[model samples]
Target chain A: MRIAVDAMGGDYAPAQIVLGAVEAVRKYKCDIVLVGDEEKIKAELAKTGMANNPHLIIHHASEAIEMGEHPVEAIRHKKDASLVVATKLVKSGDCDGVLSAGSTGAATVAAKMFLKMIKGIDRPSIATPLPTTHGIALLLDSGAIVDSKPRDLTEMAMMGSIFSKYVYGIDNPKVGLLNIGEEETKGNKKVQATYPMLKQAKDVNFIGNIEGRDIPSGKADVVICDGFVGNIVLKFAEGLAVTLFQLIKDAIKNGGILAKLGAVLVMPALKKLGRRLDVSEYGGAPLLGVNGCCIICHGSSNAKAICSAIGVAIECVKNDVTGHIRDSIAEEELLANDSETI
Target chain B: MRIAVDAMGGDYAPAQIVLGAVEAVRKYKCDIVLVGDEEKIKAELAKTGMANNPHLIIHHASEAIEMGEHPVEAIRHKKDASLVVATKLVKSGDCDGVLSAGSTGAATVAAKMFLKMIKGIDRPSIATPLPTTHGIALLLDSGAIVDSKPRDLTEMAMMGSIFSKYVYGIDNPKVGLLNIGEEETKGNKKVQATYPMLKQAKDVNFIGNIEGRDIPSGKADVVICDGFVGNIVLKFAEGLAVTLFQLIKDAIKNGGILAKLGAVLVMPALKKLGRRLDVSEYGGAPLLGVNGCCIICHGSSNAKAICSAIGVAIECVKNDVTGHIRDSIAEEELLANDSETI
Candidate 1:
């Protein structure tokens, strides 16, 4: 299967993106189509001695979307931009899936405007794999839809469960709503209303509300919430991890000779721990409920992150996650006997 | 200032609570009144060898509120419970403040019922100190009001600013409305509506919208949001810190001989770092907008956390935070030309 890569998207664009595409093409037996400014992409590829890869192809574009630009407006104006063109390639069936490490809003706008949402899906949700003690929990709607109704949250649960089962190979993935407390009536009005809807969903193994403290312990396979709360939780987790690690590093450095020596001795193990907690190591967040498989990577992603993002794209394509979600939604509708339920 | 302690509250009950109260009285130079089963509290106090301190006093109470009991129900039924009695002391002007490390819900209910709200305040808020790159940031409504309006969030910002200045010694603390993005119209309806009110408020230094990722970096001195979002962010940060520290500890334990040696050498530094990130070190969250100072410590608080909670109470009393909030609200009303506004 072929995957389109936005080579001019992330902070380490062109260089890392090209290297990642070349590595994926060489290591994983998949065709890679790199999209970016032709001259820059070629120059970066030549510098890495990866210009001769037969499985790699260049899809050039003249414009790039800035991180600060309005997502919808930028996509509409920069039609030939790397992200927009890559999304169009997926929409036209030229590629199996698309991957980008750019502005999340821009990626969402492009994916929805070009590829569109799947049938029976009201909005596309972003689902990321959160590493927990029990294993990995799938957290959805990290920032896609800011305001959502109870029904929207239920849809996210169904979509997240299917995605985890198909892509992560977890059978009967348990779905949960993230809130202040585990009780049914413990959260805001939106969560209180959504609790019953999720409980009644047929396809998902609804396990009820999961608190934020339970997230790291992997209390549920799929932790669903509205985009506003989900995004804050996701970002808070990321920031806290980074802050703690930095504090550890600072403590070692500031503690004089003994601490510096200790830091050096355990540097390898600490490095491994850092790698495990790194966001880039987990690949990209999947934009679920869409017509095509799309992964949104971090804006500052490096070569490793882009490579893992490509791997995620390949996994989604191979597992047929989109089809599984469609089937799940259809099956749930049939069970509930309501076509407008979602 | 005399602070009433719920001597039978928290996981360790009279033992840790008594020790913490003794420490607070000695270290912070504050008079302590222990409220609980008088016999048990005196027995626990004997173990700490401070039973003879002239500053320590004991109030008789025959019952205690179990953590598992419903908060409102417990307060209604257990009239002479430790927490209830302690709250009553504050209500009757027998104590300057009350400290409890028991049921958060119970503490909230008792504080609201006994201490009452400051005039012109619709609802009270719980403000907790969150660790950030630039020291501590104040986050309000950290599980107090689940459902809130735009005006509530605006009031929280004003209260939070005044709190940071008085309690944390921050001058003109930059206040930010937590949202999905940094744009003018980035978040859900609540945030969108709250933005204008925050901007219009003359009592606070409004910094516009801040994303979740910026929290750990101490992007703002005060991060204002509804209780739902605030609660999630607080728990997420706590969980992530614990998870990361556990992972680090595990890595050091299983990383062979060199890693073990490194851990031993850096044990002191690591322990200090861990302590710095510990939530218990920050003491209890103060319920803002109450007529008197009320601190709500975590349920699992140990002796150290209990002591910190009492210190928070003393700080509030010294700063006259409640009186300041009352005056600020009055000034804001006069400036807005709306005497009926809350």
Candidate 2:
């Protein structure tokens, strides 16, 4: 299968993207199409020493979307932008999926505008992986569709459950509504309204409501919330992890001679722990519910992160997550009335 | 100042609460009134060896609210509950403030029902302390006032700012609206509606929007959001910190002999870092915008946490935070129109 990579997106564009594409070709045996400015992409690819490899292709686009550009405006105006062109390839079925370590907003916009949504899906969502004690739990609508209606949340539960089962290989994933309290009645208007709808869906294992503390405890395989709340939780966890690690480092370095020795002895273990909390280690979060799979990496992602993202893109295609979501939504639509869609 | 503390409240109950109350009396010279079943409070106080101190008093409370009880229902039915009695003490002007490690919902309901709202205050908000690199940042509406209106958010900003300036002694504390993006136009209906209201408030040092990542960075002194979002962020941070610390401990313990030795050596430094992130270290979050000071501690709080919460109670009374809020909100009401108040 072929995957189109946005070569000019992310903080470490071109170089890391090109290197990751080459590594993906060797590891996953999937053809990679580098879509970006040819001169720069070619220069970066040359450093990989596999620029002439038949598995690696360069379908250069003239324009590139900047990290700060307005998502919809960028997609509308930058017709030839790398992100738009890459998404267009997936839309045309020229590529099975697309990957980017770019502006998530831009990627989501382009994906919706070009690739569109799967049948019976009203909105697309970002299905992000959060590392838990038992393993990884999926948090969906992770900054894709904010101000969600009950129907929107039920859709998230469906898509998140499908992604967990297909991509993560979790059978009968337990879906929980993210709320302030674990009680079924506790939550804001959006969540409370969504609770009954989620429980109504027989396809998902609705485990009732789960609080923020429950996320790390692996109480549920999939926790769903509005994109606004989901994004806040995801980013806050990211920032808190960074601060705590920094605090630990400073403490270890400042502690007298004994602490310094301890730091040395425990370095390996600490590294392992860090890897467990690191976002890049888990690969990119997939923008689920779109017509084709689109994986979004953090903008500051390195080559390793990009490689993991490529792996994620391959898994999504191989697992047919989008297809499963389409089928599930279609079944839900057939069983429920038209008013239930809202 | 005299602070009434619910002696039978947290996980540790009367024993820790009595010990903490004794410590508070010694440190701040504030009179402590322990509200609970008379026999239980007396027994616990005797253990602290300060049972005979004239500054320590036991107010008999026949009932106690369980953590799992529905908040409003518990407040209504458990008239003789320890939490209700403590707040009633504040209401009757017999105590300067009230502190509890009881159900947050119970504390909030009691405070609102007994003490009432400060003049022109739309809703009472819980201003929680979050540990950050620069120190601690205050997150408001942190479980109180869920599903906030635009006016409710503006009130949180006002109250949080007053809290930072008076209690934390920060001058012109930077207040921010927590949203998905840094852009003014980049949030859901609630946040987007609240943005301009905060900006219009001439008294506030409105710094525009802050994303979740900015929270741990200490970029804003006061971050305001609806309790639904605020509570999630707070809980997520707490859970993540616990997980990371656990990971570190396990990493060190499971690592070979050298790592185990290193763990012992680094124990002191790790403890210091842990204290920095510990909820009890910063004391309880004040239930702001109330007619009287009300500090709410965690259910799992120990003696040290209780003592810190007592300290917070004394500070709120000394700072006259509620009085200041009354004045501020009165002024805000004069400026903003009606229908803004919920």
Candidate 3:
């Protein structure tokens, strides 16, 4: 299988992206088309001692999307941008999937423009894998459709559940709608309307409503919400984790000799704790419901994170995660019935 | 000033409530009218050695609202419920303010029923104090109006700003609308609509938009949002903090002898960290925009938390928080002018 990597994307782009692609080619046994300026890509690959590798191919793209540029305008105007070229490669069947740690909006726009949507899918979602006490919970629509309807949320549930089963190997992933309260009646207008749709969904392992508190406790395998809320939730958790860890580190460093000794003892466990909370090892967030398997990594992702993101691309492509989502949507015919109420 | 305390409310009930009231009475030299079952409150107060204290008075309340019961239904039927009687005390000028740790819904209903609304106010909001890197940030509409309009959010901004200035002693607290992005155009319908109102609110120290991630970093003193989003944000932060702390503890405990030693050294710092994050020391969430000061404590509030809640009541009352909110609303007449576009 072949995957397209947006080499120009991310903070440590070109170098990190090239390294990640090289590592993925070695481990996942997948060919990668490095979509960016050929000279920079070749130089990075040569530095990594993978210049002559048969599995790695360079595809030159002239333009690049600046991080702050508007996604729609960038995607439309900068046709030869690395992100746009990568998605086109997927659309043309030259690559099975694509991965980009670029601006989410740019990635989303380019993907939608070229790769288009899967059959029967109204809109796509970003499935962000969050670490829970038990395991990973797939949070969907993390930065996709901002103002989603009830039917759209249901679609997200179906897509997230299908993706989770294939990606995480959960036999019957529990599905839940993010609401204010555990009760079905609780939440805003869209949440209230979506509750019954999710509950009556025969394919969904509906576990009623899950509150924000239940998120860290692993109340559901798939927690679905609109992109607006999902983005805030993800960012908030990231910020909180950062703050708390800093607080702990400061506390330990200033605790004098005894504290320093204790810190030494707990260093291993602390490392383990860090790893357990690090969900990126699994892979970057996958933009679900799109025509192709497209994974989006964080902007500051390191070589390992990028490698894991490419791994996601490879696994999703092999498992036909996107195809399964389409099949689930087709099989359930949920969107058809859901739209009637709307 | 005499504040009414719901002696029968919260998980700890009369014991913690009585203890908190006694502590507040001693520290602040404020009279407290314990509103609940007279005999039970008297007994609890007697144990605390404040039974016949000149500043402590027992206001007989025949009924109590169960935590799980429908708030509106309970407020309607349980006429002599402690929460209702406490509000009536405020309304009748018998008390300057009231504090309840019972069901938030019950407290909301009782406050709305008896205390009514200040002139020019559209809706009341619950101001929940959250720990930030710098200091405490006041989050409003935490569990009040679940389905809030843009105007309700504007009112929350005004009320929260007023409360923050009085309670936290910030000269002019920066007011911000909680949003997915810092951009003015970024957010759901309510947030988008509320943005311009807050920005145009000359009376408020409006700071455009703040994402959830900005909350813990102390980006804004007053983080304003509709109640639904506010509640979820609060709960999510609470859950994340709990999960992270547990993970840290588990890591230390299971890290063999060395890790345990590190944990020991960090114990003092850990306690300080805990104290910093423990917002309850400041007070329970106060329901703002009400006609009078009404603080709502958590159900699991202990004596210390309740004491803080009462302190919030007294401070807000002393500073004329509700009146300032009224003046701000009256000053701007924002919603009335804002409705033209909507």
lDDT at B64 for candidate 3?
A: 95
For candidate 3, lDDT tens digit of each residue in B196-251? Answer: 88887756899889887888888999988777778878888878878877888888
What lDDT is reached at residue B74 by model 3? Answer: 98
> Model 3's lDDT to the true fold?
0.86
Q: Indicate which candidate wins on DockQ.
A: 2
With candidate 2 superimposed using the best TM-score fit, by how many Å does residue B126's alpha carbon deviate from the native? Answer: 0.2
Instruction: For candidate 3, give the lDDT of residue A235.
Output: 88
Error of 2 at A136 (Å): 0.8
Is candidate 1 or 3 superior in DockQ? Answer: 1
Error of model 1, residue A84, in angstroms: 1.7
In candidate 1, position A19 carries an lDDT of 85
Best-to-worst ranking by TM-score: 2, 1, 3
Candidate 1 local lDDT, residue B90: 95
Local accuracy of candidate 3 as per-residue lDDT tens digits, A148-226: 9888898888888877888789989999888888877788888999998888875689998988898998999999888
User: For model 2, what TM-score is found for chain B?
Assistant: 0.96
**Stretch of 10 with least lDDT, candidate 2 chain B:** B333-342
User: Per-residue CA lDDT of candidate 2, range A130-168, in tens?
Assistant: 999889999987998998888888888888898898878
